[model samples]
Target: MAYKARLQEFSDTLDAEVIDLKKLRKLVFNGCPDSGYRSKCWKLLLSYLPRERKHWKTELEKQRNTYMQFIDEMIIKPGREATEHGGLADVTLDDHPLNPNPDSEWRAYFKDNEMLLQIDKDCRRLCPDFNFFQCASKHPCSRLCGKNSFETLRKRVEQTVLQSESVSRNRLGITNMSAVKRKSSSEFVPLPDGQEAHWEVCERILFVFAKLNTGLGYIQGMNEILGPIYYTFATDPDTECEEFAEADSFFCFTTLMSEIRDNFIKTLDDSQCGIGGLMDQLMSQLKEQDPTLWHKLQEQDLKPQFYAFRWLTLMLSQEFPLPDVIRIWDSLFSQEKCSTFLIKVACAMLLLLKDDLLRGDFPSNMKLVQNFPYSTFDVQKVLKKAVEISR
Candidate 1:
């Protein structure tokens, strides 16, 4: 069937609030270009979609409000000194820095200060190559907040603090890492709260996700995984869809992690189903299908963990271009067995460059594979080759 016809058929089912997964799977695997369709399709594939479509509005309201609540609680003013504590009227003598009580709200807030700093750093650096992640606001010209947003908060905190202590010193006295710093004297400067709306939104989702799943909590590279998902949703042509991207991305990401959580768990790395198992599986397939190349990679001591660990765990999101990464995900989620297909794509990636891989020594081969420019890569060609090997 033609593309529009296929979409029409899908739309009919969608209107009925019942998706035919088998059909949707075929569309996704082949490649979905319609951003609106992809936005919805992704939710379904990741199990973020309700079984009863009638409840979608309710489900969305529940999830989005939950995320907003997280933003309100987990994300707060770095109100410390009276100058900074402008917005936090709730901060009282009980919440002051000197409070040694473990249960003090300030104590708990200060406890994660270091981790928050790290997450802030990583989130800012996410997809730095892409301006979407590098800047705080995509369009700083129309932004409502920036350098002095905190100053406004300070006044609010000061008024609230006035009702209590004359002033409260910053707990941990830590600098706000989220502040936008000027990188150069160039006129084209990004604001401090720079596309902060987006980056900060991603941070809150990760924090909420950590609080929800204490076992895996927040991992270092999670921002990388979350980046593409949010970008895809936030950029959807439909304004309504883009507006709720954060809530949708969170639920989708949570479902995606459920399928692959073992990869992030330290205890499971050595297990057959963990990252080690995945690496072994990839090599095993290479050994069976392309023994010569498999042996060549192993001979150079270019272990799969060195490069493929990130590849598999991140669903190749970091390795491929953003657009290609989405296409790759289209294929990944469409399959009945996602892990099995992922190994095939990885194998196909290796096999496609068999000649370069065949001739190079250890360092040369490692650099070639690890830092290859996937931006210009032809993912369809790789998928074609991947499917051939899978059969």
Candidate 2:
């Protein structure tokens, strides 16, 4: 009965004409109700949606239509041109595949394919324990299948000859190489040519993001960050919201990325906001909260880079199951100082396993932190402990 009452309170809070974010955050910090509250709470928390309910429809339409325009300009037209021309020789005399010119469209397309391939590989393996990503979305992108549409990122990748090259590395320094080969459409088994899977939608979003943001063109773990946001919006109960899930997810993911992009940029790794600085903050917090454990870890030389790099960089998405990650994100997004609070949570995670770290050697501790024991501890407890640490 108390749970139902709290859920009702959350519903009432969200339904307010202009939401009080302070109040909303306090309610949402506990965790969103499973009955589709996250879809709205996340949008608001991420600032993708305005506080005022009256502006929602207009804002959504403008953004969704703009996203479709991006698709038409970036993906569909380029794809159609590539299809119509058949080859570089036919398309233009000046800019061929081998053109060394920086402005060459063909070069840009090939480069995008390289990034897209990496995004595809990471997205395909997303939450492998569940078939949610592999399963066909009930509301596949209709614009891509319309009379004017030419091809999607999935189709283009299968048909195009992607050059074999080393794309980029993750936080842990593992290099990813892409060697895409031409394959037939018939090879796409689970879904037919017109239909789309969840991961394909994610791939298109990341591809467009990479193209628009050339400076930080798609990183390896970006797909992991995007997966949960897309999944939350994609599974919304409201058909109208789910129909535009791709657009909604794209905007929300973009907003979230703006805040965390520094961590992914190589040049900024040691800067105040970069991953290195973040890990330093984590270690400092550990040293303050549990001096003995902090000294022990330092003596063993178990740097936060080995484990917390993935934990902090990926926002703990890779460490825990999808559901638990989402639950953790509920508290994270609600916090005013999300990143500062994240350090506190990291400290709490270590303090929770203080005994194990003290008893075990470096290898065991590395394995334990890398593969967090999510099953052993309640996520609620982790959040509560994080709160206590903050206090």
Q: What does candidate 1's lDDT look like per residue over 3-66, in tens digits? A: 7787786676566666788878887888776737888778888887775688888888887777
Per-residue lDDT over 103-209 for candidate 2, one digit per residue giving the tens place of the 0 to 100 score: 77778778777777778767766777878998888867764335445347777666545433365665654445456554433324447866788988898899888
How does model 2 fare in lDDT?
0.81
Give TM per candidate: 0.80, 0.89
Distance from true position, residue 95, model 1, in Å? 3.6
User: Could you tell me the lDDT of residue 76 within candidate 1?
Assistant: 53
Best by TM-score: 2
Runs off by more than 4 Å, candidate 1: 76-92, 134-197, 373-377
Looking at candidate 1, what is the lDDT of residue 190? 29
lDDT of model 1, residue 92: 49
TM-score of 1: 0.80
